[model samples]
Target: MVTRRRLPRAFFERPTLQVARQVLGQRLVRLEPEGGRLAGLIVEAEAYVGSEDLGCHARAGRTARNASMWGPPGHAYVYFTYGMHWMLNLVTEREGFPAAVLVRALLPTEGVEVMRRRRRGRPERELTDGPAKICQALAIDRELDGHDLCNPDSRLFLEAGPGVPEQAVTTGPRVGLNSVAEPWKSIPWRFQVRPEYIPSLAEEEQTP
Candidate 1:
């Protein structure tokens, strides 16, 4: 059986890079207004550490747009970008610290039809494949910014899933940072595991 256990606040109160790697194989869950549960297996993540990391938003220091990053761990530090797309980042490490793991992609496991409709019928594999697409597919936006993910009563939260072994993971530099200088640009902060590494839930266990 696929158990749905909420990850504790302590899970995110660790180093940013460690949280990024460990988040893979966990499930992002959104309890919809229509009383449906939408969830997916997180497959990719990228860590952006504190202010000294030039490639990170915190590099500019904490501004109104990024204030949530300085809040308690296990909260969502969602933001808008490209004047259109919304990106979701889960705050990590100590309170007042600006560090988070950007959720990059997911393997949709529940409420697939709802996600497809929200994505306007994109190909199955394309849904929730990117950070923006994940926000789009799950209806995550700025309204969810600063939301406490560790709260079971909250509409959005994360659940433990199958553990992805270290050997199955691949790491690389964060994507879309052409303007960033070297070192930060080249650092292996992104981590991912192939979808096959995630075991499929039985049909009965997949009902949302």
Candidate 2:
């Protein structure tokens, strides 16, 4: 039984970009209706600051697609992508900063049997590894938008976990943002779990 430690509200009130980098190795937990729980170790993340970030939705301000980004910190900012998948993001910074941390990849840890079922027949590597995949495996969707991540009753929340060493963590360019250009696109803000732990496409193709 893994005991989850809820992060303080102030933990999310800081700069979204920094929070994104700092959140590596933490655990993300989702409570199920039947009193069961699902969780995974955060393995990858990307940061999106306000309008200055060309890759950020907040660059457009308060539109229907990005309204949740403008809310207070510790809120979920779930969104659809590529016209097919839903991605999960956590709102960061004080109100109006419009920053968020994109949870890109996760290493399935607890309640993996449930995740395997939710993933249907998909390979194990694809289970909870990518942004859209994590949401799908965890059953997160648009309905969870703006949910309070800090609330004990909320379906989603983050937990403090073992620290990943600096040498073990690696940084790289974000995926699927070739059009952003300049430092923004090349910021190397993307973080991921050590290579050995990364799920292979073949492994990902195996169902449970």
Candidate 3:
């Protein structure tokens, strides 16, 4: 059973990489306008640290779109990308620091039917298998940009859940950085649960 205890701001006021890994096995929940909940078990995430990281959005400094990243920790940094998809990111580190963790994948545990419907009747395995897919499944968009995740009344918040052991976690380079520079492109900042820990995608979505 997952605890309803929402993660406090202090939980995110840490190194970006640390927050990314620690978020694994937690619960990402969205409370719909009608009071329904769409939640999942966080299983994959990527870290983007500071303005110096070439692969990070803050590399170019703050802008209107990324203003939320410069806000206090424990706030949502939702952004639209590729002219189509909305991505969900959680800001981390101290205020004014542009650091955040990109939530990459989730295992649907609540509101599976709604997720499947939002995902266009896709199978359970495909409902929230990727970053963009997770947003789509949960109906997250610019509306929640900079939303305070630590607020008890917030529609979007994270909950404490089972902690994933180090042995069950894996690290690798983030996806989709073809044009990014070296070192940053290959940095092992992406974190995910080992294949054996997840049921659906373990065999169907093998990774190198």
Residue-pair clash count for candidate 3: 0
What residue runs in model 1 are displaced by over 4 Å at the alpha carbon? 195-208
Worst 10 residues of 1 by lDDT: 198-207
Score every model by TM-score. 0.95, 0.90, 0.94
Overall lDDT per candidate, in order of appearance: 0.91, 0.83, 0.90
Measured on C-alpha atoms, candidate 1 has an lDDT of 0.91
> Which candidate tops lDDT?
1
Put down candidate 2 lDDT per residue, 1-208, tens digits, no spaces: 3445798778889987678877877789988988888888788999888988888888877799898899999999999978989999989999988889999988877778889999996777789878988998999999999999998788799988664667767888887888887888888878776876444422432345
- Stretches > 4 Å off in candidate 3: 199-208
lDDT of 1 at 46: 99
Model 2 weakest lDDT span, ten residues long: 198-207
List model 1 lDDT by residue over 70-162, tens digit each.
999999999999999999999999998899999999989888999999999998889999999999999999999999999869999999887
Which candidate do you rate higher for TM-score, 1 or 2? Answer: 1
lDDT of 1 at 42: 87
Q: What is the lDDT of residue 4 in candidate 1?
A: 80
